[model samples]
Target: MPFVNIKVSAPEPTKEQKKQIIAEVTDTLVRTLGKDPAAVLVMIETLEAESIGKSGLSLEDLRSKK
Candidate 1:
């Protein structure tokens, strides 16, 4: 079994966006990792803005400081 974990700053995703990302990622893993796409598990978690960063700044503090 192959396990893959992906983390991103959580954002609202539409159904089409979700399906597209899942399909593409699954297919790539199937080819590169040589694992069955069906065996791959994808977990998406929406994190608070405080936990996400951009331009070397936390979203939470960046807003207030700016």
Candidate 2:
């Protein structure tokens, strides 16, 4: 079994978008690693912008500046 964890800071993805992500990621693992699609697990986490930072700035702050 293969497990994939994805994280993003944002308002959150729509259900269709998330489904696409899951499908694509599963396909990638199946093709690249020869994993069984039924045995692969993909998890998506939507974190608070305030909790995710880059270059010393929180994602919330970065978005505000943009």
Candidate 3:
């Protein structure tokens, strides 16, 4: 069984996007890694702007700098 964890800090992704991501990753793994699609598990997490950062600044702060 394959267990996967996914995290996103941006605004909530649409359900369609989630499905597409899982499907694509699962298919790729099944083909390349010989993993079972039905045995795969995926977890997604969403965080606030302040909780995520880059270059020593929060994502929101980075945008303001650009």
Candidate 1: residue pairs that collide = none
Using all chains and alpha carbons, the TM-scores for the candidates as numbered come to 0.65, 0.92, 0.85
Candidate 2: count the clashes: 0
Q: What number of clashing residue pairs does each candidate have, in the order they appear?
A: 0, 0, 0
User: On residues 1-66, what C-alpha lDDT tens digit does candidate 1 reach at each position?
Assistant: 556565655465767876777778888889998998779877555567789888998887777787
Of candidate 1, the 10-residue stretch with the lowest lDDT total is 1-10
Error of 3 at 2 (Å): 1.3
lDDT tens readout by residue for model 2, 1-66: 899999987789999999999999999999999999999999999999999989999989999998
Q: Is candidate 2 or 3 superior in lDDT?
A: 2
Query: What C-alpha lDDT does candidate 1 achieve relative to the native structure?
Result: 0.74
List runs of model 2 lying over 4 Å from the truth. none
Q: lDDT per prediction?
A: 0.74, 0.94, 0.85
Candidate 1 off by > 4 Å = 53-57, 63-66
Per-residue accuracy of model 3 over 36-61 as CA lDDT, tens digit each: 89998887777878888888889888
Candidate numbers sorted by lDDT from highest down: 2, 3, 1
| lDDT for 63 (candidate 2) | 92
Error of 3 at 25 (Å): 1.0
Ranking of predictions according to TM-score: 2, 3, 1
